[model samples]
Target: MINYICNKWKAIKRAKNILKNKNKIPPYLKKNSFEEELNYKLWSTKGARFSASHRNHTLNKLSSKSIGYLSAYLIIIGIVNLYDINLLGIKILNNQVGFISTAFSVLILLFSQLESSENFSLKSERYHNCSLDIAELYTRARFIKNFTINPITKQSELLQISIDYDAILKKYENHLPIDYLQFQLTKPEYFGLNFIKIKWIWLKYYIKVYAIYHILIFGPLLTLFYIAYLK
Candidate 1:
C-alpha cells in the first residue's frame, strides 16, 4: 500500500511538470522578442477578423430591421393617404396617421444614422484583408517549421519568417479589437466544416435574412395594394 501511494504521488508530480513545461514560453518568445512579436501579430490579426465578422453581422441585422420597419411605416401612410381605409368601420384621421408615421420615421432615421456612423461593412473588409496578409505569413512560417530539417537551414528560415512577419505587420498596421465572444465564435471549427455543410449552412442563413427583410418591408405594401384594388 505504501508503494502504491508513492507511485501515485510520483505520477502526479510528473503530470504537473509536463503541464508546466508545455505552458512555458520559449526564451526566443520573451517580451519584445522577434518570435513574440510574430506570435502577437498572428493572434491580433485573427482576433480582428473575428471581431469584424461579429460587427458586420450585427450591423447587417440592425440595418435590415430598420429598413423593414421604415418600409412598413411608409406603406401604412401611403395607404391611408391614397384610400378611404378604416379600422373595423372606424375611420382614422389623416392628421393622426401622419403624426404617428412621422414619429416612427424620425425614430428610424435616428437609428439609421447611428448604423451609418459605424460603417461596419468597410471595417470588416479591411480586417479581412489584414487577416489574409497575416495568414500568408503564418502559412510560410508553418511550412518552414514542417519542412526544414538541417539546423542551419532551419535558422535561416526562422530569420526569413521573422522578416516577413515584420513586413506584413508594417504593411497592415491597423487592427480591430476583439471581444471574448467574438474570439470564440470565429475559431477554426466555426467555418472549417466540410465544404457541403458550409455551403448549406450559409445558404440557410442568407435565406432567412432575405425572407425576414423582404417579408417585413414588402408584406404590408402588398397587403395595402390588394386592399386598395378590392375597394
Candidate 2:
C-alpha cells in the first residue's frame, strides 16, 4: 500500500512535464515501472488544461455580448442627440426627458451585467479547483488500494504507497498547489482599469451633459411658464 502511494506521487510530479511537451504522453503506467507512472501524470495534466481553457473561452464570449449591447446604446444616444429638437422649445421637453430616463436605465443595466458576469466567472474558477482536489484524492486512493493487495511485488511497494499517499494528501490539505484556473479568472488589469476607465469617463460625461441639458431646457422654461401664468 505504501509503495503504491509513493508511485502515484511520483507519477503526478512527472505529469507536470507533459504541459511543456508538444507530444505529451500518459506515463506508460505499469506496476513498479516508470512507464505506468508517466501515463497517469499525462492524463491528469491534460484534463486540467482542457477544463481551464474551455471555461475561459465561455467567459470571454459572455463579456463580448455585454460590450455589444453597450455599444448599441451609445450609438442610439448619438443619433437622438443629433436632431435639432431644442429649437422647437417647450414642446420637445417631454421627449428630452424620456431620452434622459432611458440613458439612466442603460447605465444601471451595464453596471449590473458586469457585476453578474464577473461573479459567474469567479464561481467557475472555484468549481474547477474543487474538481482538481477530487481528482487528486481519487488518484491517491487508487494507489493505496492497488499496491496493498496485489501479490505482484515486494514489501517496498507497500512502504512506497504509504509515503506517496501521505505526501499527496498532505499536499492537498495544505493547498500548496497553485491553481492556474484561479489566476485565469482574475480580471485583467487592462480590462478593469483601462477599458472600464474609458467607459466610465464617457458615462460620467453623459451624465454631466444631461444634467446641464435639464437646467438649460427645463429650468428656464418653467420659469417663463410661471411668469406667463402656466406653472
Candidate 3:
C-alpha cells in the first residue's frame, strides 16, 4: 500500500498526470495504456464541467448586478431632476441626464431580456449536475482499479465507465476549451504546470470568463461617474 501511494505521487509525470504505474493497482499494464488515457480523460472532463458551471454562475451574478446599477442610476437621475440644481448649468445638466437615463433604460431593458434568454442559472445547474455524474464515474473507476482482482473484469469495468463518460457528454452541451484549460490550471501537479504557466492559465481564464461581465457591469457605472464629474 505504501509503495502504491508513493508510486502514485511519483509516476504521474506525464502530461495531465497520465497513470504510468499500472503495477500499483491494475498491475499488468504498460505505460501509455488505455487505463492511463481513461484516467486522464475522466479527471480532466470532471474538472472542466465544474469550471463551466461556476463560470455560468458568475455570469448570472454580473448580469443581475448590471441591472441593479442601471436602476439605481436612473433613480438618482430622477432625484436630481426634482430640484433646481445647476452644477453644470440647468439646461446642460438636463440634456445630459436625459440622454443618460434614456440610454440606461435601454440597457436595463436589454439586460432583462438577456437574463431570461441566456438562462445562465439553468445552464449552471446543468453543468454542475453533469460534473457530479462524471465524478461518480471517476470514483467507480478508482474503485475498480484498487479492489478488483481479475484483470479482464477490471478492463471491462473501466471500458464501461468510459462508455458512460461518452454518453454523459452527449447528453450535455460541450464545455469550452477555455473551461478545460481552467481545469488544467486547477491541478498544476497533474498538468506539470509551472508558476508562470499557472498564472497564464488564470489570466486566460479570467479574461474569457469575466472580461465581458466586467465591461457590462462596471462600464455603465463608470460612465455615470464620468458624466457626474463633467456636470
Candidate 4:
C-alpha cells in the first residue's frame, strides 16, 4: 500500500512538471478587457470551490456510512454475547454469529481497500488546497482591477494573474471537473446555516442514524444485566 501511494504521488508530480513546462495563458486573455479578465477569474475560482466542496462532501459521507455499518455490526455481536439472548427470538448459535460477523468484517475490509485504492479523500484534500490557492489569486486580481487605472500597468498585472492561474491549473490538471449534479448539491443553501446550527444538525443526523443503531444493539444487554441484578 505504501508503495502504491508513493507511485501515485510520483505520477502526479510528473504530470504537474509536464504541464508547468507547457503552461500558457489562453489566447483570448492576451488582449481582454479588465472586466472580462475579472469575470474569468471569478468564474474559475467558483468552479474550483464547487469541485472542492462536492469532493469533501462525498468523502465525509462515505466515511460516515462505512464507520456506521462497522460499528453497528460489532455492537450487535457484543450485545448478543453479553446477554446470551437469541436476538429477535431467532435461534442463532455462536458459530452462526461468528460467520455473520466475519462476513460483515470482510465486506468492510473490501470497502476500505476500495476507498484506499481510489484515494478519494486524498484527491478531495488536494482539490480543496488548489481551490484555496486559486481563491488567493482571484482576490489579488480583484484588488488589481479595482486599484489600477494605467492601461499598461493593468495589462501587466492581468498577464501576471493569468500566469499564476495557469500555474495552479497545471498543478491540478488531473482533477475531475464537478458535474452538474455535484454543483447543484454544493449550493450555499445546503450549508448556509451558521456554524453552530450546522454542527447541531450533523450531530442530530449522526445520532439518529448511528446512535440509534448502537442503542438497539446494546439495549438488550443492559436490560438483561439489570434483570439479573434485581433477582
Candidate 5:
C-alpha cells in the first residue's frame, strides 16, 4: 500500500550526494536528516556473532564525571609541576621528588587528552540512528512513486520495493563509528608527541624518578669531584 515517490534511483542519488561532499545534504532534504536515522538502524540491525565484531558493536558512553576527574588530576599535577619548575628550578628540584612527578604527570595528562578526543557512545548513537533514518526515508519516498512500468520487465515498480538493508548491514558491519573510536584509541602511534610514539609515556615517569634518584645519590659525590677538579 505504501508507494514511494523517491524510489531506488532517487535513494541511490541521495547517497551519492552525501558521499561526494560528506557535509550537509541538499536543502530540500535537509530538514529531515537521513544520516541520524540511518545510524540508528545500523546499530539495531543484528549481524555476525564473532568476538571481534561483537566487541566492536557494543555501546559505550564516557561519563562527564570521568572527564571531571581527569581534569582535576591534571590541574593538581600541573600545579605541582609549576611549583617545582618555577620555585625550585629543574636543577634544584632534582633534590626533591617534584621534578620527576611533574614530568610523569604531564605525560599522563597529554595521553588522557588523546584518549578522550572521541566519544564512543555518542558516535555509535549517530551511526545507529542514521541507518534507520535512511530506511524510513526510503519507505516514505515509495509513497510518492508516480512512475509505472510493465509487469514482466518493470523499469518502474511501486514505491514499496524492498531495500537490501541486510546488505547495508553486512557492508558496514565493522566500520561503525564506535569501531573508529576504538581504532583511534588503540592506535596511539598515529597521534603525535615523542613519548606516546615511543611507548614511553608510562615509562617516562619512572625514567624521571630514576634520574631524580641518581641526582640524590650522586649529588654529593659530584660536588666533591667538582671541587677536586678545580684544585
Candidate 6:
C-alpha cells in the first residue's frame, strides 16, 4: 500500500500530460481504448462548461458587490464629511470632497456600463445550460459504457455522441484554461492534485475572480492604516 501511494504521487506529478499522451499512466486510471475519445470529449467539455458557468455567475454577483462596495465607500465619505470624523476624506483624500465624489461617481458609472456590456448573468446561464447538455451526453455514455457489452455497437453510438459534442461546443464559448484548472481541482481522483497545487489553484481562482475588488476594497484600508497608525 505504501509503494502504491508513492507511485500514485509520482504519476500525479506528470498529470499535466495525462490526456494529451499515454505516458506514465497510474494504476487508478481505467482507460477503455474503445471509448477513449468519446469519454475524453464528454468529460473534458463538461468540466470546462461547468467551471465557466460558475465563474460567470460569480462574476455577475461580484459586479453587484463591486458597485455596492464603491457606493458604500462614497456614502461613508459623505457621511464622514457631514461630521468632523473624516479620516479618509481629510487625511487620505486631502478633503477634496467634490473631486473625490465626482471621481467615485464616474468610476461607478463606468463600471456599471461595463457590467451591462459584459452581461455575465446571461453568459452564466448559457454556460450552465451548455454544461448540462454535455453532462447528459457524458452520463449517457457512462451508461452505455457499463451496460453495453458489444464493442461494435458501443463504438458506433459513442461516435455519434462525439460528433454531437463538437456541434454543441461550436454553439457556445469555450471555457478558459483557468476554468479547466478549477475543474481538475474538484476531481481529485482523476487529477490527483496535491495540497500545494490545490492551494495554488485556489489562489489563482481568487485572483481571477476578486483581485480587482480586493484591491479596491483593501487598498484604501491599507492606506488608512499606514497614515493613522503605522506612520
Q: 1-231 in candidate 6: lDDT tens per residue? A: 999999998898777566566644633245656476677767877888888999999988888888888899888778766764757344534357767878989999998998889889988999999999999899989999899999789888888888888899899987888998998887866677889999999999999988987787677668667777754
Worst 10 residues of 1 by lDDT: 173-182
lDDT of each: 0.64, 0.48, 0.81, 0.64, 0.43, 0.82
List where candidate 1 sits over 4 angstroms from the true fold: 1-44, 47-51, 61-65, 81-92, 166-180, 186-231
Backbone atom clashes (below 3 Å) for every candidate: 0, 24, 0, 0, 33, 0
What's the residue-level lDDT of 170 in candidate 4? 82
Listing every candidate in turn, what is its Cα RMSD in Å to the true structure after a full C-alpha superposition? 8.5, 18.6, 9.9, 16.9, 18.0, 7.9
Error of 4 at 24 (Å): 29
Q: Give all TM-scores, in the order shown.
A: 0.52, 0.31, 0.78, 0.54, 0.28, 0.79
148-225 per-residue lDDT for model 3 (tens digits): 999999989998999999999999999899888888877777566799998998898889777876887677657646
Which portions of model 2 show Cα errors greater than 4 Å?
1-64, 80-118, 150-231
> Residue 135: error of model 4 in Å?
1.3
Candidate 1 lDDT by residue in tens digits, 136-182: 77777667667878878867877887787677667643543333233
Clashes of 3: 0
Error of 5 at 60 (Å): 7.9
**Cα lDDT, model 1, residue 165:** 63
Would you list the clashing residue pairs of candidate 4? none
Q: List the residue pairs that clash in candidate 6.
A: none
Q: If the candidates were sorted by their TM-score against the true structure, best first, what order would they fall in?
A: 6, 3, 4, 1, 2, 5
Top TM-score: which candidate number? 6
Tell how far residue 164 is off in model 6, in angstroms.
1.0
Error of 5 at 97 (Å): 5.1
